[model samples]
Target: MAVPAPRTVRTVAAALSAALAATLLATATATATAPARAERQHRRPPHTWTVTEAAHAPGARIALDDTTGALSLAVSRDGRTVIEPSPLGILAQQADLSQGLRFLHRKDRAVDERYRAKSGKRLDRRVRMNETRLSFATAAGARLDLVVRAAADGIAYRYVLPAGYGDVLGETSAFNLPSDAGAWLSTYRVDNEGRFNQYTAATAPTGEYSDQALFATDGGYTLLAESDLTGTYSGARLAHTQGTGTYRVELADSRVHTDGSLTTPWRAMITGDLATVTGSTFTDDLAPASKVADTSWIRPGTALWTWLAGGRTAGQSLGAQEAYVDYAAAHHWPYEAVDSGWYFKKDEWDVTDPDWRTDSWMPQLVDYARAKGVGIIVWIHQRDLDTPEERAEWLPTLERWGVKGVKIDFMNSEAQSMFQWYDTVLAQTAAHHLMVDFHGATLPKGIQRTWPQVMSMEAVGAEEKRTNTAAHLTTLPFTRNVIGSMDFTPGGFQRVGLRPNSDAAEAGLTVAYESGLQMFAGTPESYDQRPLARDFLDQEPAAWDDTRLLAGSPGQEAVLARRSGERWFLGGVYAGAAHTATVPLAVGRGRWLVQTIRDGADGLAQDSQVLHGGDDLRIDVVADGGFAGIACPWHPGVTTCYR
Candidate 1:
C-alpha cells in the first residue's frame, strides 16, 4: 500500500474554523450579550480544556491560570492520575511563550487510521487519538500552538510555531512525579549507552537523563519520552529539580532556527502497566509516514556478526568472511556483518580515501555471499562518512559491490546537526536501496517509522558493553526497546568471561530483544555446540505480525509472545535468583504443538508437548537464566514444527 501523507494542522484548523463560523449565526442571540465577556477574554481565557481518548480511559487536561498566565497539564488513566499538574511553555527567539500568554482559539478532532510498517514489533498499526490544537499569543503577540494527542495508551503534546512566529529557544516542560515514585533512568550520554538504575524520586541524582525515564507509581507505569525528532530542533534530556520530584526539559542545542515555521517534537507520556508500555506504538504513531515509496526491498532478518566474538579484527579476509557466509547460509540466516577491519587498520578512518578499497577483498566475499543466497553488511566508522561528499562517493560503491547494508558506527552524538545528518544518510541509503544500522548513536525516536530502511540502532548497553546482567536485559524491553527497535547483539553462546547470562538466557534475548537486524554475536563453532538454541534463532523471524507482553516486571522478568505467519515464538528472561512460573498459552483458540528450549540440570534442554489455549506451561528458569519456545498449530500427522 502507498504510504499516506501527513496531515497538517493548518488545513485541519481552517476546516474547523469554517464549521465554527457556520454555527456562530445560530448562537448570535446567546453570544450578543457576551461582548463584555469577549473584551476580557484575553485576560481570562478558558480556565481548563480536556481531551479524552475514544475509550475515555486516558486523557490530558490543560489548565491555564488566568492570574499567573501559567499553563499546566495533568494526565489520567483508569480514573487515576499518572502525572500531576506539570508546567508547559515554550521560549522563542521573537517572544517568550512561557508566560503572559492569552488563548486565542481551540480546535479539536478525532483521528483514526492504520498503516503498514516495513518492520517493527508489529507489522500493521492502528493509530487512534483525540487531538486538540490550542492557539495562544504571547504578551508580545507571538503566536504558538500547542497540539495535544490523547491516545488510549498515552498522552503526547508538541509545540507548533505558526508561519509568522520566530524560531524556538527552549521549553519549560516537565514531568512531575509523586514524591514516593521510583524511577528507572539511564544517565544522559551522547552515545546513550548508560545503565538504567533504580532510584526514588527524591533521591535520584540531579543530572541529565536519557530520552526515557520509566516511573513506577501508585497508578501505573509511565514512560517519559520524546517522538518525531527532526532536524528543526535539538535532542532533549531530563534534569532533576533537586529533591523536588520534578524533571525539567534540557535541550542539546541552545536555540533552534528553521525556515518558515517550526514544530517541536512531541513530549509523550506512555502510561500503563509494564505490558502496556512494552507494547505501545506511541513513538511510531507520532512520526511521519514512510518516505521510501517502494518498501518491498526492505527485509528484516538475523545476521551473524563476527566482531563481537572475533575481537573487532576478525573476518577481514575473504576466506574468513566466506566461512561466516557459509554459516549464515547453512542456518537460513539472511546476512553476515563483517565488522571494523574490512578496509582499514585498527582504529583508523580510511573510508573516504581515494584509494580506500584499492586492494579490497570485500567484493569477492560479497559476490560469493550473493551466490550462496546471503548478504554482506560491512561496518564503517562515522568519521569517514560524516560529510555529504564522502557519503555520496561511498554509498554507491557499496551498492555496486552488492553489499546489502552498512553498519555505521561511532556517531556518539544527538545534536540538531547530527539528527539532520542521520536523516540525510538514511535518505541516501534509501536511494541506493541499502539498509542501515546505526551504532554508537542516540536512542531511537521514531526514525524507523520515517525511514523504514533503518532496521535497528544500538542505543542500549548491549553485548559490546560486556556488562549485560539479567536485570539490564529485562529492563530493556520496558525502556529502550519499548520506544523503537534495539540491536543488543544477542545470541552470545560462547563461554566468554564477559557474558554472565546462561546459554538459554542468552538465546532467549534473540527473541526478548526486538531488533529488525538481530545480530547474533557468537562464533560459528560456539553456536554449533547447542543445536536446539541455534535452530531456534535460525527459525525465528525478525519482524512480527503481532506482539504481546504476556508478563513482565522491570529488572526482574519479562516474557513476550510474538506471532509471525502461523507460528508464535515465546521468550522469557529472569534476573538475580532462580524462579519458576506458569506461563499461560494465550495464543487464541487452537491446539498447538509447543517446542520448548530451556535450561536443564546439565545444560540446554528441549521438550515438546501438545496444549490448548489457556493451558499453563511451567518453566524452570535458573538463576540469571531464561527460556524460549515456538508454538504451532497441531496437525494430525506432524508432531513437531519449525519455521
Candidate 2:
C-alpha cells in the first residue's frame, strides 16, 4: 500500500507551530534518552578510543592515534567511503569496501608496478609517527587529528588534514548491511567546480572515457556522490581528470545491506574567507556565510520567467517589447529575460567591453522593459572577470543598471583550484544583491540553501542552442535538478529541422519538465506565429516559490509540482521511451483551476486546454511526453480567479 501523503501547510503560522512542536519534543527527549553506551564511549582515552558500538543501525566509528593524527573508520557495512584528512589536507583514501580490498587509486600500469612487489603483491603500511599529530576537543568541541603517510606503493604520498576543519567535521561510510539499517552515512564535499562535464583524457584512468563502476544495490543502501554540474561528455574535454590525485578513495571488503529504503545523507562542504583570494589561484577558499540565505520564498504556485518576450533582436525589430508588455498586462506573466549580446556589442563574442553606452538604444531598451511590470535579467561572461579588479568593477555596474540577474558563461571547471573560483563568483554576485545563472558549469551543491538569490544556473544544454533532445530534457530533472534549481532556457520558438522524430512539440515537452528559472529563446515574431503556443507562453510561470518531487528518478521519468501562493503548478516528463504515471493531488484539494499542456496523440499539439476542478483528475501520458497542470482555489462569487 502507498503511504498516505503528509498534510500541506496553508499558512506560515501553521508551519511555525509545527516547527516549534518538533523542537520542543527534540529538546525534551534528548536529555531523557541518553545512552549508557554513549557515556561509556565518551569515557575512553582520547588517543586510544575507537567506536565499537554502532550509534545508529548503520554507523561508522573513528579511531585517531593520540600521538599521531592517523585516522581510520570501521564501517558496519562496506560501500563507498570518503575521508577528509584535515583542514588544508590531502585526500586520505577513496575505496570500495564491497570487494573487501583497497582499490587502486590510479590504473597507470607503470605507476602501479612501482608500488607493488615483484610478485605483484600488495603491501601493508603504517603512518610515520614523526609526521602525525592527534588531539581531542576544541573550543567547538570537535575532534582534530592528522597523518602524514605514503601509500603502499610509496610513489604516492599524502598528508591528511586534521578533523575539525569545519565547525563540525566527520567521516561517512555508506553501505547496505545484510539487514535493516535505520540511518545513513553523513559525509559530503563542497563542489568547487560549477558543473560536471566529462572525464579528461589526462585525468582518465585510461586514455578513454571511463565510467566509475559503482556496485548496484537491490535492497541494499547506496552512497551517491553529489555534484553541482551537468552535460554530455561525447566530445568535450574531461575536466574531472585534473583532480584525480585529490579524489576521495575508499578501502573496504563487503557490500552494505539496507531495508529497501534510500538511506543517504545530503552533504554540504563549508569553506571560508572569499575576499582574501577573490581572484587568486588558491581555490580552497570556503563559501562565505552571506552566500547562504533563506529560500522560504518558494511556496506552492510562484512564477518564474519562462522566456523574455522582447529582448531578442528579432523581437526588437517586430516590437517584441510592446508585445511582451501587452502580454504581461493582459495575461500576468511575472518575469522576462534579456539574453546575450545586450551588454556587449550585438553579434560580437567579446563580453567585457560594455557597448551599451555607445549603443544609446540599449538604455532605452532597459528603460522600456522596466516601464512594463516584468523584471529584467541580463547575460554575462565569466571570462571577462579574468582578474579580481575586473570582477569588482563589472559586478557593481551590472547592479547599477537595475538588472535583476546576470548569467555567467564559459566558466573553468575541473581541479580544486577552479572549485574555489566557482564559490567566489557566487559570493561576489550575492554581495551585489543580484541573482546568478551559471552556464557551462557543473551541478549545484546546495548553494541554493545558502544563497537563495542564486536564481538559476545552466549546467545542462538547455533550449537556447537548439540542440537538446526530448530524451535529454526528460532525464535531467530527476538527476541534475534533484540537486537544485536550473536555468534551462525553455520556451524556444525556433525548431531545429532534424529527422521526422525530431519535432518542436518534443522540445515543448522538455520545457514543461524543467522546474527552474525559465527563459524563452526565439523571437517575439516567431512566437506570435502560433497563437495557441503564444497563449501557453503567456500563462506560464517564470519562478517557483516551493517545489515538490511527485515521482520518478534520474535518466528515466519524473514529475514535479511547484507552488506559488495558493495556486499549484505541476509538470512531468518521460525520458526512456514511453511510460504512464499517476500524480496525487494532496495540495490541490481545496479547489483549483487546471491547465494542461501535453503532446497530443498526433504529436503536434502546442497549446494546453483549461479545465475547472471538480473530481480529482487522472491523466494518461506517452513517452518523450509532457504535461502541465495548474490548480487554484475555487471561488463562488468571483467569475475569473486567474490574474
Candidate 3:
C-alpha cells in the first residue's frame, strides 16, 4: 500500500459528499459525549503545512496556511538561515486571495529536465527540482493556484489563474531579509543601466522602482529577480519601506487585465555561496522552452563595431564598413555591425529606399561581405520594425540582400506592449532566419531560451557611453550578467571622455563578461597599435561549454575561468589599489601551456609559460587594472596551443 501525503486536504467534491454523512454520525456520537469537549475545538489555530522532499534538504523550504490561505518561504545553507519567512500571495480583481480563504487540494511531484542551450553561459543544462501545487478558494468563491519549486540552488514560485479572472491588481510577494544583511542594488531605469551601490539592509533605498537586488547574509548570498515574462504582464520592480528589511513587488502598470488564463513569470530567489551566486543558472532554467524548430542558422560569435571609435563618422561610408569587414575577416570574427547612417538620413527610420542609385551601396557591401565569409548586421531604430506589418515589409528584403542579423535599437521600455513587441519581432526574425541584438533595451530575462536567435542585448552601461567605472564593471557578473547575456562592448584600448579603466582591464572585460554576440569596441588602427591585445581578442570564444568562479567577489575583484573545448580561459578584474592576484589553475591534471596578458607600466603586458594543473598563476596589477590568459594542454617543445 502507498503512504498518504501529510497535511493535504481532500478535493472539494469529495469533501462536499462526505460532509452530511459525517455530520449525522457526529450528532449521534455527541449524544454519548460531553458538550464542553466539542466547544473547545473551535479555539484551535489554523493548520500550517510544510513542503519538502522525502529527505528534507538544507536549502529553501516552503509552507502554506490552510485556513488563512497565506504562503511564506524561507531559505537556509549549511544550517544557517539566509532568508526569513516572507509573505507571498496574489490580489485578484474579483477577491482578495491573500486572506479569508479555504484550502481545496494539494499536489506534489518531482521534475527532472535536460536541454541544450543555443548560446549562453553553459551549452548543456539540467534543471532538477521538487514542485508543489497548492489550490485555494477565496471568500468570493474565486480559485487560484500557488505553484512552488524547490531546487538545489534555491526556490521559485508563481501564480496561476483560471479564465474569467478579470484583472490582477498586484502581488503581495516580498523578500524579508535579516537585519545585518548587506545589499547591492540598482535604481530602476527603463534601460536598466544604473550603477549598483552597496548598503545595509536597514539603510537600503526606499522607492517604488529598482532592478535586481543582491544580498549577503550571514550564511550565504541571495539574488532577487524574475523570469519568463510575456506580453500579458508588465515587468515588476521592488517597493520598499524606509528602514525596513523588506521589499515587495510593484508592477510597472497599475493593473493588468486578463480575460483568459494567465501564468505570471517565476519570482526567483537564487541563494547560495559566492560560487553559487556567480555560477547559478536558476534564472534561465525557469524560462519556457525554445519555440524555434530549426536552430542551425543561429551562430554566436564576435563582431567588430565602429560606433565606439568615432560615432557615426566612422561607420557612415561604404569604405569604412569594408574596412571593418576586412578586419573581421582577418581576425576570424564571424560578423561586422553596420551601425546607423546607412540609410538616406542619419536620424530617420527609413530603410525602404526605392531609388536604386541611393540604395545600391547596401547590396554591393552585402555581396562583398558574403564573399569574404562575413555576415553583416545592420542597425535599425526600434520604431521601424516593432509591428508585424513593419517587419513583414523589410525583413524579407534584408533576407533577399543576404543580411544575417539585425541590431534593433532604442526600445527603452518594459511595459506590457513592449514585451509583446519583443516576442513578435523575435519570432519574425527567427522565421526569416536572422539573429538579433537589442540596444537601449531592458535587462534580459531568459527570452534567449524561448527564442535562441536573440544573440545579445545592450542593457548595461556599455563602452559606447564611457560612464562605467571599475567598481561598476566588477559588480555586473554577480548581478545583471547572472540572469542572461549582457552586451557591454568590451575590448577598447584608447579612452575618451570619462573613461577611467586601464588597457589591461579592457582586455580582461573581453573574457570576464559573457555574451553571445561579443562586440569588440575599437578601431582597426587601435588594434594595430597593440598587436598583443589583438592577439588575445582573437583567441577568446563568445560562448562557453562550462564556467567557474575561481576567485574574488562582487565590487572587489572577479576572477573567472571558462572552458570552450579542452582549453580554459581566465579573466580577472580588480578595483581600488594595485595588487597581485593569485588564481588557481583548476583546469585539469596535466602539463599546460599558458599565455597571459596583464597590466604594465605603460600599457598591456604579455608572457608565455608552461605549468602543471593546480598551480597558481599570480599577476601584478595596477589600480583599476585587470588580466587575461589562455591555458592549453601541453607536452614537451610546444610553441603554440592556439592558431
* Least accurate 10 contiguous residues by lDDT in model 1: 1-10
lDDT, each prediction: 0.85, 0.40, 0.80
Please give, for residues 30-64, the per-residue lDDT of candidate 3 as tens digits: 88675766666544555455544334333555565
lDDT of 1 by residue, 1-643 (tens): 2333335666788899998997887588557868777668656654799988855457798988887777899988777878988999988767777878888899999888888887788999999888999998867778878999998788999988866556677899988888778788888988899988888776898798896889988769999988889788889999985587898998988876767888889999988877788999888998888899999888999999988667455557677788889989999999999988787643223556666575477888898999999998889999989898899878999999989999999988778988888878888999999999999997778888889998999988888776667788889989999888999998878855787788888888888889899999988888888888888888988999988887788998888889999898998888888878678888888799988898898879998999897799888888988888898999787677785
Q: Give the alpha carbon lDDT tens digit for every residue of 502-551 in model 2.
A: 23333344334443455555445655665545565555554544545555
Candidate 2 Cα outliers beyond 4 Å, as residue runs: 1-216, 219-331, 343-359, 464-471, 496-516, 525-533, 540-545, 576-581, 586-593, 601-617, 634-641
Cα-lDDT of candidate 3 = 0.80
For candidate 2, the 10 contiguous residues with the lowest summed lDDT are 116-125
User: What TM-score does structure 2 among the candidates reach?
Assistant: 0.55
RMSD of candidate 2 to the truth, in angstroms, is 21.5
For candidate 1, what is the TM-score? 0.90
Per TM-score, what order, best first? 1, 3, 2
Please list all clashing residue pairs in model 3, or write none if there are none.
none
TM-score of each: 0.90, 0.55, 0.90
